[model samples]
Target: MAKKKSTRRPRARPEAADAPPESANVAQDFANLHVWQIQAFRDILLVAAIVALVWAGYALRAVTVPLLVALLLAYLFEPLIARLSQHPRVSRPTAILGLLGTVGVVVVLLIALTLPTMVRQTTQLVTDLRDERVLARLVELQEAATSQVDRLLGVFSKDETTPDGPETPVTGESDEESAPDGPIPGEPEAGTTGPPVPNGPAVMTEEQVRDLIDERIARERARVAEAEEGGAWWFTPGTGRVARGGWQAISRMIGAVVGIGLMTFLIPFYFFFFSLWYHDVLEFFGRLIPESKRPRTLELLQKMDFVVAGFVRGRIVISLIMGLMLAIGWMICGVPSALVVGLVVGIFCAVPYLGVVGIPLAVGLLVLEQLGLPEAERMGWLWVVLWPTVVFVIVQLIEGWVLTPLIAGKATNLDPVTVLVAVLAGGSVLGIYGMLLAIPLAACGKILLTEVVLPKVNAWTRGEARDPLPLN
Candidate 1:
């Protein structure tokens, strides 16, 4: 009876008993935040990280661009190596070396055969743009054209003088002879001219202006030649950077020919290694993904492989055929620098819709004929412009109707609008290389979102049963 009475005396503390579950589980609650909880913060952090990474990549582009280009080129040439290896007595390494050697020889021959013409044409273009005489000729033509138009409209009337100039024949050659010859009398030339002209600015004739421009161009070209021996493009494990001094440094950095040559030399080596090691490399990367995600990851990888193999490799083939076609057409049409233009257009056409830009560029180069050279040899317009269009259209017809179907086979099923946006975005982000790489990356993204992301999301919403791989 006494022990039962004592039970009522042992009462618990109300504060301890009344404590809320939320306080005890504060860490777990924070860790277990749902997608809706603090979602913006998480998303913002992720976006910031991605942007920072991209900015860093761009900042280090001199290093990264070459590596990426090499990797992609390796993908493009892997099949060729495979085909070459299939022949009896041809090992993989031998095939790689042989194919590369053949490519190098072909390239050297092309350059040796066509470089003089390209150089001559380019020089002419530069001269026409900068020379006052050429510009004067252009002005004369403009005035003549305007007078003709005015007469047609009767705005000048029969009694009126030619618009903005003395009356002249339709050719309007008078102004070409009208440039004043002597320095104006009363003005003093700046700096001493032997004895008299020290107080005023120097007088310049049209010829003098043209000469000065030519001198400047020559000097700049000399600097460009100097720049060819300039600094390294990327850091090396054992070597420090070459020091470049003066304004020439800026030009050298931009022109960096030694770096370019190094990269060119390195490409074949890297390409060979990439093909040689691709399986090992792929396996290593594959092992990186968690076992649970391997199925979807492998699927996406296979999709990317199809695109790289069919589209990227096939583009190289298409470019070669198209370029050869255009080169032959331009040569037949007598277009100057036909080889160079064809080569450039062919290379760029590897990019989707880039052919549009390439075609216009080829046409503009043709129109450079309007500037003509020294009253003698200004011959880019015969069928240079017109025939390129024919070549382009015929190539396009064949490309669309036959080549793409047989070779690339709709590897990139992206719509034109999507391709355009991707190209623009790529260019804005990383320039020419980005433009080159954009479509394949777009295809990868589309595959991931359509086949992986959306399905995962829908399944999650429905709380579907899973078939996750067994954990390692």
Candidate 2:
């Protein structure tokens, strides 16, 4: 018994326990650290990542913008391709090719039908604006308006006495007679001297205007001929400054053309590849998310996709329809450059309420067209104003009642004030691209606030969530 029951059992071997009980307490101490500390670290990391991403995008805008545009195109067209490919007869590649081919055919047809007329009208419009006849008419209207205003003022004045001195009427003949023969000793001559200077808004005879126009045409032709012959078209016998200006203009035009060409090529190249790999691309990004957070993230992303697709696709279709309506209406009303104006208005229509800007543009062009016409042939002022207004109103009504309800269907749900603010902020920060993206971004922000942020705040308030570490 004495041998079997020693007061202290044999000491446990060192191999049975590597560390003391204090090591377990140390782990418990670390686990007791405030939840806010870990959360703060996460928050800081997230903000840093976002800032880095934004900086990278901005720095690589030249490359990124085209890629973004392509991605958007891919987003727009992918659904159609997917649907088409679901048919047993149509493969995805075939679906893509067919859909794209159809779009290409439609676009080519539209260009073939509309381009020549648009080009001719554009040229004519430019010529009309520069016409001596048009200028003389505008001057006459201005003087007539001045005289009418003066007569009205005279009627209201208490003093009827005329000035003592012989009043020199505002007339071309008087200005010409009083003109100096030579340039002022210290001053420069007129910058452009070829077109005859009609003193005091003088009207020129039809023959003189015709002759001047012919001379201008000949000069432009000569410049073109020189350019074709590999000579400096900017150089003329009498002027040196024009050479530099002309060269600058040509350089700018070339730059613009090159930029446009590059964008045209890159957009299609990116779009074709993006469309082919659309699902794969999405899956790649999806894999980046942690498995635990994926389901919630995917839900949010799906909601965002709905909003963006509804807004973008529906708005584009609505705009196109409205543009066609406008063009047809204006053409029937004999508004000059109707196609061009309608296309411009359509682009403006992408932003809510922004299409209103096109009204003044349409009216101004109508007025200009009327001014260039014979008085007998010109539309009444009432018709000129009313027709465009009617067209705009009708189209807007259809857009509001039909297109919005049927297509967009409250996807954004943003109030007008919110939208206006978003548009303004976006336009100020990123110009047109920002403006285009603003509403969708605002919608996404609203979703995040309501779904992610507000719930967290409420829970925290009720002591159901961790308190964020205070900045102070």
Candidate maximizing TM-score: 2
By summed lDDT, which 10 consecutive residues of candidate 1 come out lowest? 232-241
RMSD of 1: 13.6
Predicted structure 2: clash tally: 0
Alpha-carbon deviation at 152 in model 1, angstroms = 5.9
| Candidate 1 lDDT score relative to the true structure | 0.75
Q: What's model 2's overall lDDT?
A: 0.85
Candidate 1: tens digits of C-alpha lDDT, residues 351-461: 766776667766665555444554356553445467768877887788778988898888888887998999999999989978988988998899888987889778866
Report clashes for each candidate as comma-separated counts.
Answer: 1, 0
RMSD to the true structure for each prediction, in A, is 13.6, 12.3
The residue-level lDDT of candidate 2 at 197 comes to 45
Worst 10 residues of 2 by lDDT: 192-201
